[model samples]
Target: LHAYAQVVGAMPRAFAEAHPKWWHVSLKVTDHGLTTDPMPLLDGGTASIVMDLAGGTISVRTAGETTATIPMTDGLSARVVGERLSAALGELGLAGDIDTDRFANDDERPFDAGAAASFWDVARLVASTFEEHLSGLSGDVGIVQLWPHGFDLSFEWFGTRVETHEENGETTDHPAQLNLGFYPGGQAYFYSNPWPFDADALLGVALPHGAQWHTEGWEGSILRYEELAGDPDGPAKLAEYARAVFEAASPTLMA
Candidate 1:
């Protein structure tokens, strides 16, 4: 929970740097284990943006009582989403900091593999909603990586089709696949140790090609994964990726 709070603290500052046009970003948090119903954070009773970390998944919802939620599985993926939040702040141009006091954590529940499963489900749920919102945007939008819990769903936008692939084969269902990102489970283990945050030996799960870490990029119709073995500066590259994803996805967010 302390680690999550630290990341939460950085979100507002990062968003302020991205798109500094909007006034405020909404914030929210929900957990299945909360003994009492949680309250939404509001400035003047109008819901802005929310960050929900409960049932093992962490999600970010736009202003108003979130009618939509997407689930994210990877802890590292949250860092990417944080980048988007930063970018959204820049777009709003509010010239102030986001109120992140709404972030909630379930301390009663020990962080474990099963708890992590719940977290991934929540992430996929929220990611699906994010895809829907971005698809409807009038401007160009790019989805770099859909890191569902464990597996990485790679995608590229081509006209109306969303090109994607995994270890199995190729898929073109953008919305459907986004929804399916939460399906696979049972393989992930709760990582108690601090995430490597770099290319140092990846501790969670191995990629299909046995690479330690992989990143996704969209170029025309191709979704590319540049896999690296191990580098002393791998952690730095991971940080860069986190910032980029956040900036790219921030436009659609209310925050």
Candidate 2:
């Protein structure tokens, strides 16, 4: 699955100029898995990629040409899969390379089908919850997207509160926003971070079941998937947790 994600990630970087919402927005998710629209090459050809989270395979479909399949047959590493994709791209005359820099871990970690299924299930539930939370907001809220870099599915709500900070003796300014993300991490966590955080905002707030206000390394609230998986009311618990965090931070963040 990780190798498949890398293959899809490369398509965006290579074809960024062809997309209107930049390459980042092209990454999408379906009940089946993560998908990308057929991207156009300068030579009037398109390379479409889909990572079948359900099937455990990466499929490349070229317009007017045969589709290529690379199965997640056990121990396929990212470099090996990338090489296959590069050869496939060459065959179709697509302009791009399978970026090795951000390919992160191409190690031969065995695939786990059962765990992936559970992760996807959690993702769907959280994605729907994101939409529910966004429906009432008037701010600039991005659609839920799966960022290839971190392999985290997330959406951001922009608030007009910008802040300036000094980093390495250089000053930088950034807009305030809240990120609600779900990741298949070491612990599989859902996170909510309000930028330029007002630490006092959540000082007295109590997080919902399965959630905690995380302050180590970063300022944010975390909902551990392991805790939610065992809860019968997982969706409700997540929604409640998000609401609690947003409510606590909105006064300072949204004001």
Worst 10 residues of 1 by lDDT: 189-198
What's the lDDT for candidate 1? Answer: 0.32
Question: Roughly what TM-score does model 2 have, to 2 decimal places?
Answer: 0.85
Q: Which candidate is the best by lDDT?
A: 2
Candidate 2: where are CA atoms >4 Å away? 18-26, 43-45, 62-66, 104-106, 165-172
TM-score of each: 0.24, 0.85
The parts of candidate 1 lying over 4 Å away from their true place are 11-51, 62-70, 77-79, 89-113, 116-255
Residue 86 of model 1 has an lDDT of 46
Quantify all predictions' global Cα lDDT against the true fold. 0.32, 0.74
Error of 2 at 174 (Å): 2.2
lDDT of 2: 0.74
Error of 2 at 45 (Å): 5.8
Clash pairs (backbone) in predicted model 2: none
RMSD values for the candidates in order, in angstroms, are: 17.4, 2.9
